[model samples]
Target: MAVAPQVLPHTAISTWSGFVYQGKLALYHCLKLMSSDYAANRDLKLQLESQDDFAIFRRQQCLSMHQVKAYKDPRFSAYSDGISTQRDNARQRGVALAYFHVAREVTNVPATFVADYGPVRFYTYPIPPDAAGNVIQSFCPLNQVDMFIRDELSSLLVNAAMQPAWKNYIVANIQNTLEAIVNLKVIMTHSKIHESTRHQTVIAASEFIEFSELYDVIEANDYAPFENEAFFLSRLQIDIGTYYQEFCERQDSLSQAACQKLDDYLAAITSLNVEGMKAFLRATMPHKKGRFKTLSEFKDQSLDRDAMRLGMFTIFWKLVQTARNDGSDVAFSWLNDGLFYYPTGIHHAAEHQESICHDIMQQAISEDVECLFECGALITSAIDRPSISDVIIGIDATEGVDTAEHELLRENRIGNYKKVAMISLNNVPESLKDAEPD
Candidate 1:
């Protein structure tokens, strides 16, 4: 009887981080093979299974040793020269191994492994150390794998564009992969992929399918509150300045000392000093006898208190901007009381069109802006309705809203109700005061 030809499985040997790269690489190759007849011609079928911290690629029935005992054993170190020796031994036993080193410096592996075991690929995932020279070990490996996938997909997209059938198949599959990742039920290491890369990949896939629309909806759902709060704050800042200036110009009774105090109050507000703002209000606009018997009466008479009340209209006007900007078949109009034609019909529109809207909002929230929750709630009430129309948001709210709003109104003012409605911000609706973002 003739000896059988020993079939060698394609093996990837690396540490935990390297397993991430291996998994992505295997997925990429699997996609490539499925999109063409290449794998069928070679009688090969690549299947991938994700374990606890690593991934394994199964070719037919043969299971790689790294997947079973090696990855689990804490004593098993990838840096050891034994890795190279094992690779050599695998080669002799009709198995091929590719070793990936996570770090730039390879210490345990000898020069002989470098010379005989083919080129040792080093994946240097550059993660900057903190002020104390300590690395964030959790993010390092994920970052490296993300960088690898981003580069691979980018190159694949460019090359796939040449072949129509291959392009269509790959694009569809990549879009599906992205959707799956986004809709993942549980949080995993893969969830921490860089936001920029995710957006780029989504945009790239959108060119071939309606994936961007879906991605935009997902992004808006995730970051709409933060984006709305940022917008509301920008509008309120302007409203506060306008009210303060108007009050100072009209009131001859406002002394130089009072003006200085008002300036200090503005600064405190800008810096997000909540206690300082409260203190200023209490000290300068406290309730008095006779005419000002209650805090509400004092608030009505005081310029600073009036300005605070006037700031509520900023939320109203921002929502008006949102409604008017919405490209819907149903017309939108602001009533005399600063309420829209269909107040219940309005919906929150995403402020930014960039795929990185979530990241932008995350950064904004991290800055710890004052009244974030309140502003977000007010904006949410204006837009979060059951019957919402088509919303079209095309402004960079991170920049000054005045400029963006002017340009937006100029371009998209057609078919909208043009009646200007002016209302005192002090008389905000009780419903709006009670509402919150969902």
Candidate 2:
């Protein structure tokens, strides 16, 4: 019996993430080509233009460049258009044209060279004709030594699929890019205070979150529900009311300052004032840095903040379920006072609380659980600067809290924690540790 040809999995290039992955894959291929070229002749210094996804280099004092594209289909018109555009771009960049595409197509119009790289076929354009007006044969390199290097690099790209380490590197990069985009969108949409500052903060937070594991947990847990803005606000309003009523019932057991803080939170939630809510949380939360603070003090405060945020997320998730479950229109407060008691037992208290406030605040705020969760996570990750493992551990430890609320929080926390933990460098596939990209 004849063996069947193996079919490689088709990756969609339509979605934003897919498009980015395709670009990165193309870059990876180009990088391999550059490395191979360097190995052949160290004098040939090749540089890749990341912005345009093209390789440009000075060969024998003449500029030569290759633009790369990955296409799923062999549409002649699309291919022709891409070639023309890339040629134009190369001309503008002052370089010779050698366009590369991942797709394989047998067309009569252009001088093309085809080479197979594992399961994928790469087509290079503008292969010069011979003196007799005959085109160079496909897969036939003008130079045998250059072809050998090309084959080697191509094999490496193909082998990347077979190697766990290379696979992890590719997957991690794609995931990190997608996460950064998600984080930026979340921060941009929800942040209403201090436009310039917020923009800068969002950029910084996004850069940090792109590589960090915190946003993964926030994203996975649906803590930033940008899509369900109205529903989330309504549910949050209801949960806040419920929390306020509960607080009143237990006012006798709580301290005067704690009760006052709850009253402030109640007022903020009732009015749908995000700044006020932020203030309430900031004042109550114990994650601020203080003068003359010890290393132990910082770590303890960070752990406490992480736990409280995790617990808060747990409460938020419960409220979301409640909203989904009978379409509960009843108003109840959602913020858990159990997570943080104000003015007492709070470490690293804000020294200049009034100075910390931003003058430019959102007049009207629309927020979901995700936005709330993202804000806290960003603040902790960017400002607190806790170790990734410490943050994960702190949040994960919420699983052990004895209270019913903490139990509810713990169940969801475990899953989110696991999801984020898997992406961490220490927890990623062992092969990833050894993988070095071309």
Candidate 3:
């Protein structure tokens, strides 16, 4: 839903893919208010300090300055990985406060503001995965009081660039702030997504929005697991599974065929004999027995299910395209499913796809039938309107043949093709000129 910077038809679903960084900042603000410490305040009033992106406060007293920096580039240190430099910056801010004597002037400020000192923390979204493939939150506590002045101070001197005295003065001011900067912390914002806390957030958010469309809205807004922390965290006491079931029941446009396939797929996955499947897969993938074994251990991982659904959808889409081309008159069985749920437009669904190959691969590994997979895929890829297939391919041939990369490239490619297809459809000739017609 948050595939690009556009709005979905007949729905409030709109997205700004470029504003990912800004959205994270907003998420951070909501997270701060969700904190137990802030919420427990008898008079929990706060204001936004635009000095940094946002500074958290309560009762006119500032607590922390949240500087959100999204680092997707491999060269930069991700917040999940915890870097020494980020910690050092936090330490430097603390040192600067001491050196500038700004903390001492706290009481001299106006009554509208509290001169309280707080940590300058950097928050990064999409916390990187650890060796175990789990999202990890990294927090570095840099103490200004504990840092060795001689070593820390000397490290700042670049003899070729500046004199030691000047560097010392600069580093001192930067490290110690008149704000009495506290320790720096680098947090992985989405670290708890797979945990119970995330379930709680999801359940709570459903209270304000339809549970069926809650994730869709959050995902479309910024791809953050939870867009508004305050609303999502409000009803944390609800039963997540129960609410989710209720949400699913209310989804109006889903095709019965799609639902049936989903049920069968889930049943097949649940009924798998992990040990038997591992042994069976090991005969051909002798060296990768461990991979199958590990996969078997996690019976229905949401991510794996999503991927499976995508595969199913892609295959079904190809069938639909073939059927449409052949001019089959059997009205589509899952038209509603295809229209409301899928991620891509009808014309662009399965563009650049090798659906037959996927069908074979899926049949080999899954107990579920290929038709079931196709139905699932069709439902997932559904768009708002049904149109003739666009001629544009989802990705350039030069982009390489990786499936994941193709899916990524398709996000950008599919939108353009849909626009072209719509224009073509709208610009039909005034009347069909037959051989007999002038």
Candidate 4:
């Protein structure tokens, strides 16, 4: 029954955690339905006859019912009065009963229940130690279950039934019960398969009717929450081969939908350009060398387009410092076509419309005059004390260098001139001294 949009409907909290919890509950119920229905499909009915967390079952002509418990914690406490009551209830109701827990460690069966019905068995998790290094206390492994059940049933049959045909029927019923238990384990382990199968079952059940209306009808009838579980079983029976193929297709579609939703969620949080800018800054930033000169230097000041300019200035200062410490001057040719060299004239002529290198350098040089002055001091100390003429003329040249369009070309040429000047000022070689006075 489709709900009318004009009518007020039931209200519920809209939260992701709620969705997750509800989905898990739905999956649990669905698995239970599949387990029961699959047993019925095999000509055996394992009813959901218990309200507590247990699988209670009895087969045709069988003298014993089994209660199966699957749980996380493995430490089994002593048999409680509650279990004894359940056992008495089963006996009073004309059914013999036994109980088993899935994990290792279980209390001893009540002596009265054993005398009245049969021995309680334990069906545990696999043999390998779990995360906490504890093996489940199983009556026997799955491989051993067949022989174990057969032998136990034989003992029960010795006095319970004397007729051959009746004994055979009871044995067959025990086999059916074991098969159901095995199938239940398989379903629990491969939960995805159970979930997918259940989804198809629910969808098929609601094909011609709105699920909400169907749910409302079921609730109004005072039936169980999943009243239409049998409906899904009927739907699954129609062409199971087709149903499996459709299930694979639906699984593929779900994978695609999940990926697209993830992409949409990520795109909603961040812009493409912001990501690109971050990439640029990470690639260009100067890496570790020396410790910072001041605490203020530890804070990031590069947040905008000027970040690249600041990065270059810092790198240039480091280069100058390294050269001074090594007692060697760097050749201008060494920086040719390198990251620090700025050739705006050539860049502009090529119609490359990105941020110009010369402009970046001008901004960097103008803003970091203290760093430039320190570099000049280091350069002077590394070579020789500058003469009055050298100091006066060098400052005049430095002022004009930042304003030039082809700053790298001029800078490289000026480096060659400085090298020549240093050689002349220190020691004029005999060959050059004898040649001519420039």
CA lDDT of every candidate: 0.32, 0.31, 0.27, 0.29
Q: Which digits, one per residue and each the tens of the lDDT, describe model 1 over residues 332-377? A: 2233344333221112233321222232233222232222111111
Worst 10 residues of 4 by lDDT: 338-347
TM-score of each: 0.26, 0.27, 0.22, 0.21
Instruction: Report the C-alpha lDDT of model 4 over 238-286, residue by residue, as the tens digit.
Output: 1121222222223323333332332222122111122232222222221
What stretches of model 1 exceed 4 Å from their correct place? 1-22, 28-43, 47-78, 101-109, 115-141, 158-438
lDDT, residue 431, model 3: 27
Q: How should the candidates be ordered by TM-score, best one leading?
A: 2, 1, 3, 4
Backbone clash numbers for all candidates listed: 1, 16, 17, 2
What is the Cα root-mean-square deviation between model 1 and the actual structure? 23.0
In terms of TM-score, which candidate is strongest? Answer: 2
lDDT of 3 by residue, 259-354 (tens): 443333222222223333332222211111122224323222212222323333332322222111123221122233242112211222334234
lDDT of 2 by residue, 78-161 (tens): 556545555554454444445444424535443342221111223442335978875543232212323333343344434532
Mind sharing the TM-score for model 3? 0.22
Order the numbered candidates by lDDT, best leading: 1, 2, 4, 3
The best candidate in terms of lDDT: 1
